[model samples]
Target: MKKKWLALLLGTSLALTACGSNDDDNAGKEPAENKETTTAGAGDAAKIYENKCSSCHAVNLEGGVGPNLTEVGSRLSKDEIEHVILNGQGGMPKELIVGDEASKVADWLSEHK
Candidate 1:
């Protein structure tokens, strides 16, 4: 009985060890097309909006903690929008995004209207 228990324990340990090796084996080898797709998705304006502004502006940009920006383009020019993004207004914080990322987000918001 003891021998059977020891054999069972040994088998379980080996099985668990084998399972853990597969994940580490694939960590460093992303395909080029996959990398391009991921990078594109990361920089896309809509994705950026969803990640950064959705919480305050609402998922559809219909407004929530912030005013509805659905027609912001009509209300503000692209430069104005960029200014606001960099400068903030009222309850919003300044410099929420910076540099090229800020410009991309601003351009997206300005065009959505």
Candidate 2:
């Protein structure tokens, strides 16, 4: 019957559409944890900043290509600092940073201010 054939064709089409959509969730994605954040030896933010942030921003507010990082803690909250470091701001580039490495650098920046 025409009705039976139409129903079977519709069911097959729906199954195919659903199967294709399942791939959308995994489109060559990378995990956020895999992104590298700042890292310096000796296991602390100060060390991380010394190695990573010091290249651009001066800890004492002497100024550099980036803004003087002094008082950064007072000016920006921890979340703000983390966002800036992770996502970047103004002319800053978005460097690869994530997970504990990101937290360590944020803590170090918070203390340096």
Candidate 3:
């Protein structure tokens, strides 16, 4: 029984780690051809959130590993949200998105209230 429990724990850990692995293989390198070059907007912000945040924050902002952000705007101002996005907080890693992309996402999320 103890061996079975240990194995299960290890398996779960491995699975979570794999799921959380960064997909950005070319960090700090030139953007890929498929990458969007236009100015970030509301729609782009949603896409960014989906690709970079949904794994933990949930696609619907319903929360999962990260806190629920359905009404984050009511809780935090746009500046505060942007700060968190740039600096991270608690279990979240910093700079998941930056620059205009981060600003746009923060603006989009700030409207959730």
Candidate 4:
């Protein structure tokens, strides 16, 4: 009957639409390796800065509540930068960044300077 055929067609269309939507959640997620790459290693230091330091230091590190981090390497050595990130200085709190992340950001700032 026409009613039966229309009902089947509508059901099939709904199922297909639901299946297509299921991928939307995963579309926003990077693969595991890419996620790790964004948070780890030499290349990811800028991403870490954007996540943590950009708020205070400004997107380009031109300074904000914190001092301009642009060319910070020229002002501080890598070890000094790492020490500050771990210990904090002045208005900044200690451990704004910690562990290997501290070292990576320090390395990045120093290199940019």
Candidate 5:
């Protein structure tokens, strides 16, 4: 019984750690060289999504741990998306990608519909 409890505790801890936000992925990395003339190009935004959101949201915007975002634009405006990104909603943690980057991502997502 004690061993079973210990195993359960260990598993829960690992699961929580995996789900927790990880903000250090790009801590020391330099900005990308490619800069689009537009406010937020598809390429740049997609890259950001891949780096910061793909784990839960999926690379194709299909549902994973998070809801499907394929038609998110039809459901929510850029401002709403930005608000969610900044403040988090439901199970999502806040400030995953703050500042201009968040805005850029919201803009890109707003075009999905």
Candidate 6:
């Protein structure tokens, strides 16, 4: 076991040193590409909205269980959205999905609004 461990260590050490750290050099060399660009377009939030929030927001946000969220982005910041999502105000149902789940929903709402 000791010999095997030493051999593995030696093999990895040589392989690692042989590979230069060019990642940093190449990173900033190219003009920034649209990393956010998604070929599928938008995201699953749209579907989530249709399935979930639709009970309230009603797509265009004419009216529903909650007030119209069409202008939610203009009114609410990402942090506010997260807060509301986690802690629920008036009648939002405190911290539903949690963590990044709320963030994804916030971003989705922001885009539509």
State which candidate has the highest TM-score.
Answer: 3
* Candidate 5 Cα errors over 4 Å, as ranges: 1-43
Better of 2 and 4 by TM-score: 4
Stretches off by above 4 angstroms in model 3 are 1-43
**Model 5 CA lDDT for position 11:** 100
Candidate 2: which stretches are off by over 4 Å?
Answer: 1-39, 59-61
Query: Global lDDT for candidate 4?
Result: 0.83
The 10 consecutive residues of candidate 1 with the worst lDDT sum are 32-41
Error of 4 at 52 (Å): 0.8
Model number with the top lDDT = 3
Q: Tens digit of lDDT per residue, candidate 1, span 1-113? A: 99999999999999999877575666887864444223335688777677667889998999999989998998898899889988999888887666676788888888876
In model 4, the worst 10-residue window by lDDT is 33-42
Model 3 clash pairs are: none
Q: Candidate 3 — what's its lDDT? A: 0.87
Clashes per candidate (backbone, < 3 Å): 0, 3, 0, 0, 0, 1
Model 2 / residue 30 / CA error / Å: 19
Judged by whole-model lDDT over C-alpha atoms, candidate 1 comes out at 0.79
Q: List the residue pairs that clash in candidate 4.
A: none
What are the C-alpha RMSDs, in order, of all predicted structures?
5.3, 10.3, 13.5, 5.3, 13.4, 11.2
> What would the TM-scores of all predictions be?
0.63, 0.57, 0.65, 0.62, 0.63, 0.53
- The alpha-carbon deviation from the true structure for residue 90 of candidate 5, after best TM-score superposition, in angstroms, is 0.7
User: Cα lDDT of all candidates, in order?
Assistant: 0.79, 0.70, 0.87, 0.83, 0.86, 0.67
lDDT of 5 by residue, 37-60 (tens): 233445488888887888899999
In model 4, the runs with Cα more than 4 Å from the true position are 1-43
TM-score of 3: 0.65
lDDT of 6 by residue, 2-102 (tens): 99999999999999988958677667554434332222235466654565456666876655878888888888887787788778877567755455556
